[model samples]
Target: MKIKLYCRRALMTLLFICALYTTISSISNITLADMKVWAERVQQETNHPSENSLKKSNLEQKTMNEQTYRPKTLEEAIDFDQYETATVLATGYTAGIESTGKTSEHPQYGITFSGVKVKRDLYSTIAADPDIFPIGTILFIPNYGYGVVADIGSAIKGNSIDLYYDTVDDVYSQWGKQELDVYIVEYGDGTLTEEALKALNEAEALQVFRQQYIEQ
Candidate 1:
């Protein structure tokens, strides 16, 4: 009787150990399967796309970049004569030398003109003729470097453009009066119309004497 009882107890202990091991193994397998499913779902979401959204975004960016820097039409690409004004290129010289009689020690060595100023009136021209040239234009001059259309000018009234020189010497040295082609860079205000430009030309550009100087 004693031996039979001892044998029964040993049998029950072995069964309990097997049950625990089976439960642990089943739990581990379940956890691994769940992890794999989650990883697959994440990858699928990342790979999927709605439509041509990416392509459309890329195209829009390209257009904007080209419009910002490149001139599309022939009118956008124009050439004009440049007039030189000053001999030296320096900032704030006028203010510095206004009080002091001394002019040479101010840093820049160049002749200053009293009455004339020149500029390229890009906005006005674009406003006058959008068909010819659009706003937000960029221009490139080979020898003159690059300039943006910041504002309009009275002399730069038509398809004409005005170039600025640092000095009279530079203007003469570089042949300021000669014609040069200008590439339309970006866009700005507008282009000048033919009619407006003609009117500007007909008007008196300069006045030498006021009026009625009859030997008084």
Candidate 2:
């Protein structure tokens, strides 16, 4: 009888241990899920919403559902401009990142430099070829460059270009307030199509920017 009782008590202990393990495992999974949700919410709140975010979310869902996610090939990624209004604006170094000791928010995203400092109100200048370049067109700088169209400048009225320098030292040493040639790549249909604008509007692009600021 004593041996029977001992066996029963041992069995009960084992069952309790198994239950504790399962509870711990469940709590761990919940914690991880909560962290992921928090990160996503932070991203949506900070960056402007756009098609990029939509695409990314779709990709994430596809990956979860289908177990795979792949980006477009280099050739597929290249967007060529075809609109008659499309123009090639002169390019220059984006100047502020390395100089300011800050990394780019989006390395793939490109912009024209308007001045040495980021203005109090995000004001800056671009090349004087707005007729060719237009105000809202986006361009890619090969390296050491970064920017977005926040505002235009009076002095930067024409084919002339402005370079961004994070600090006075950067202005003198790295940028030197010079003009450089920038290449404009065309993406999607000609004339800054709604799709292209939507692409720009996507949350992924803004999320990239937010990440940069957060790290800084």
Winner by TM-score = 2
Model 1 Cα lDDT, one tens digit per residue, 105-211: 54432221211122222211211122333333445444444333323333334455444443345445653454545555454455433444334323352111112
Q: Which stretches of candidate 1 lie over 4 Å from their true place?
A: 1-136, 189-216
Off by over 4 Å in 2: 1-129, 185-202, 205-216
For all the candidates, what are their Cα RMSDs to the real structure?
17.6, 17.6
Model 2, 88-200: lDDT tens per residue?
A: 23333343554333456754233333222232111122333454445444444322222233234455555554444344564455445434444444321213333333444
TM-score of each: 0.27, 0.31
The whole-model lDDT of each prediction reads 0.40, 0.43
Q: State which candidate has the highest lDDT.
A: 2
